[model samples]
Target: MNYDIFNGDADGIISLLQLRLANPVESKLVTGVKRDIGLLGKLTEKVGLSKTDKITVLDISMEKNQTGLVKVLDAGVDVFYADHHRAGEIPTSKHLDAHIDLDADTCTALIIDKLLDGQFHYWAITAAYGDNLIAKGDKLSNLAGLSVELSEQLKELGTLINYNGYGAIVEDLHFHPAVLYTALLKYASPFDVIADNSSPFYRLQNAYQEDMASALAIKPDHQSDKLSIFELPNEPWARRISGVYGNQLANQNPKSAHAVLTENRDGTYTVSLRAPLSNKQGAGDICSQFETGGGRAAAAGINALSKEQIGDFIKAVEAFY
Candidate 1:
């Protein structure tokens, strides 16, 4: 069996999309909500591995999935992995092929674009936009000779696809990432999706506008010279929009770190932390202080943070910058 496992966000989805478009294949799609990085283990638990099984993993942290990766390799499975997150120590095994880059401006899709020599260049640019690497996306778009209007269309498409991945669970999302991916696979090009009136692009665009409006109406729960914090209710829309809202906040105030905390039903919080855009450093370090926290330097997250530690989290971000 062939397994195609990826992050549910734009980078992961688009990364896999480009590869599959370049070389169409038959594989079992494995993905989840944006925060579900521990996916390899889930696959291992549900489907016992075999010596001939082939796996492709994208966008998730190799460090977090190392255990499952080792297990699969031990079982003689072949694996291909690519990502831009912090990889503690890569395993040396003939069965594994890994591509990882820690550059702040690069994403998995961009990495795959380099590998494919820009065969699906526009999709990679869209993924960069969705991942909030705004400057990188714009530069790539310009180099591709895309007009300003077309660039905006790709930007919106990328942003909407990215926003769809933020939910706490599949139920919280407008469309499951798997369904979205399958629907997107029909289009040979990103522009084709935009041209088709029945495409998911329209549905996601409308949903994003409604959710973002609600988020914009709220005042920051905490604000200081170096940091700003916003608390969102426990609704599905809040869970779906938290990450993008944090990105918006970071872009709005490039010098100040921002936190978007969505209340969980269990009296905890789901935290999305973005370091200052002006100094994209220390966010991963600060988030790592919590047991449920981990991410890249510019953007990190805490899966479920206790209410009592909210103040401590703010202090850490404030002190870091």
Candidate 2:
């Protein structure tokens, strides 16, 4: 059997979309909420693997899934892995094909775009937008000769799709990432998804507006010249909008680092950290200092940050840039 394991966010979902659209496949889908990066482990825990099984893993950090990956490879399962996150040490195995690029500007979908020679270029561009590589998305769209209006449409679609991926759990999301992927597979191009009024694009748009409105109503928990911090309550909407809200804040205040912290049920905070748009270099480094943190230079996140360390996190960001 073929198993498709991917991150539930826009980058991972759209990366697999481009590949499947180019080369149709029958595979068991494996995905979860946006923060559920330990996907290979879930697959191993849920079902036994076989020597004949083939797996495609996307977006999630290889280092996080290293143990599960080794197990699959030892069982003779062929794996195709692609991502932009930190990969500690890549395994050397004929059964594994890994395409990993740590460039801050690149994403998995864009990596697949180059591999497929841009067979699904528009989708890749949309994924770039969804991943918040805004400038890169616009540049690619222009190079593709897309009209400004069409490019805007792609951006909105990407943003909405990305928004749907957030949530403490899949149940909090309007559509599970696997279901969203299935729904999107029917459309040959992203434009078609936008053209279809019944597509998840429309549903996500409505849901996104509601969540963003609630988030916007909350005042920043802490604010200063160097950084700003917003603490969201432990609600489904808060979890759904934390990452996107952080992005919005960073864009609104280009010179200031921003952190959006969502209260978890356990009293810890799920933090989304964005370095100043004017200086997008230290976010990942700053976040990596925390035990539960790791991400790219432009944007990073901490899975669970202690309430006490909140002050320290703010100071670290301020000191970095």
Candidate 3:
């Protein structure tokens, strides 16, 4: 048995799409929600790798999944990992091959496409757009045969799908991202998703638009010259829409950094930060002040914050700006 382990988001799906196109492997897909990574162990349980069984781990990292990865390699599985996450202390297993670049500009999907000489460039662009690599997506879009208008629409789909995968759980989203990925898995190009009338990708796109409209009903927290923080209550709609809301706020008002927080079901919160595209990038620094997260200049996330720290995060953002 062969396995394709992925992150269950745009990058992961598109990464697998690119690899499958190049290698044409009919492997079993092992994926879950965005947070359900470290999949190598799960695959190990399914098929304790013989010399014939193989695994492709996409958009997940040795850093985040070190323990699980070690278990899989120790079990004699042949695993290939492609990721863009920060990694440390490279493993010495002969059965493991890694393609990890923490470059903010290139995601895993794009990396695999590059490895395959861009055989499936459209999916690469979709993954880039979904990851909110806006400038990179624009360039990739131009190369992928999208007219300007269609390119923007596909970008919307990517952003929407990425945004929905956010939230603490599936109940927070209009649709589970696993379901969305199932809808998208058959297509080689995102355009194929839009072009196929029978495809549910368009339906997912429409649902996201409606949900984004609902999330935007709230106003900015404080619209300073440098930052805009939008707070979302612990509601399903708000959680479904937080990531897109953050990106929308950042894109529509590029001069200001944006923080979009969704209060979680447990009364904590998850934050999506899209810092100003300018030079004053302090997102990772601020997020590291708490126990929750660390990310790049333009985009980042904080997984969970205690109720008390919620106030501190708000106060810290003021200092960050």
Candidate 4:
């Protein structure tokens, strides 16, 4: 059996989408909420795992899944990994084909785009937008001769898909990531999704507007020249909107870093950190200072940050910028 293990976010979904579109495949999908990077472990426990199995991992960090990766490779399963996150040390196994580019301007889909020689460049551009690579997406759109209106449509589609991945779990989301990915797979182009009012694109677009409206109404919990932080109450809406809210804030003030903290059930906070757009560096490093924190340079996150560490997290961001 072939297993498609990917991050639940837009980049992860689109990376796999491009691959499957180019070379159709039937594989079991493994994914979860955007923060659920510890996915390979789930596959390791599969009962029928054997040498004939193949695995393709996208967007999630190789560093975070090292143990499961080693276990699977040792079991003789061939694995292909593509990501733009902070990969600590890639495993040197013949069974592993790892494509890791930690460039702030790139995402997993873009790496696959290059690998496929841009066979599905439009979908790659949408993933870039969803990953919050605005300038990169805009540049690519121009290179593709996309009208401003068309680019905006792709941007909104990407943002909506990205926003849908933010919930604490699948139930908090409007559609499970796997379901959403399956629905989207039928469309060869993002424009088709936008044109079909019955598509998930419209459903997510409507939901995104409502949640973003609520987020925009709230003021920052802490604001400084270098950093801005917002603390959200423990609610499903808060969880769904946190990550995309951080991206919106970063775009609003490109010079200041942004952090959106959603209160968790266990009296902790789930942090979505975005580095200053002008200086897209140090986000992953600053978040890495805390436990349960990891991501790419431009954007990173903490799954659960205790109240006591909030001040320190702020100070670290301020110091870095």
Writing each residue's lDDT as its tens digit, candidate 1 over 1-321 gives 889999999999999999999999999999999999999999999998898889999999998898999999988999999999978889899999999999888999999999999999999999999999988899989999999899999998999999999988899998899999999998878999999999999999999999999999999999998999999999999999999999999999999999999999998999999999989988878988999999998999999999899989988999899
Q: After superposition, how far is residue 221 of candidate 1 from its true place, in Å?
A: 1.1
For each candidate in the order shown, give its overall lDDT on alpha carbons.
0.93, 0.91, 0.74, 0.93
Clashes of each: 0, 0, 0, 0
lDDT of 3 by residue, 170-283 (tens): 565555655666567677677777788877666667778788778768887666786677778987777767776787777687667788878877877788878775533677
Cα displacement (angstroms), candidate 1, residue 104, comes to 0.8
Better of 3 and 4 by TM-score: 4
Lowest lDDT block of 10, candidate 4: 41-50
Compute the lDDT of residue 269 as modeled in candidate 4: 96
Question: Ten consecutive residues with minimal summed lDDT in candidate 1?
Answer: 280-289
Looking at model 2, which ten-residue stretch has the lowest summed lDDT?
A: 276-285
Model 1 CA deviation exceeding 4 Å by range: none
Model 4 misplaced stretches (Cα beyond 4 Å): none
Write down the TM-score of every candidate: 0.99, 0.97, 0.87, 0.99
Q: Once superposed on the true structure, which residue ranges of model 3 sit more than 4 Å away at CA?
A: 41-52, 143-145, 171-179, 280-289, 294-297, 314-321
Tell me the tens digit of each residue's lDDT in model 4 across 1-321: 899999999999999999999999999999999999999987787655899999999999988999899999998999999999988889889999999999999999999999999999999999999999999999999999999999999999989899999988899999899999999999999999999989998789888889988888888899999999999989899999999999999999999999999999999999999999999999999999999999989999999999999999988999889
Residue 181 CA displacement from its true place in model 2, Å: 0.6
In model 1, which residue pairs have backbone atoms overlapping below 3 Å? none
RMSD of each: 0.8, 1.1, 2.7, 0.8
Clashing pairs in 3: none
Clashing pairs in 2: none
For candidate 4, give the lDDT of residue 319. Answer: 89
Reference-based TM-score, model 1: 0.99
Name the runs in model 2 displaced over 4 angstroms: none
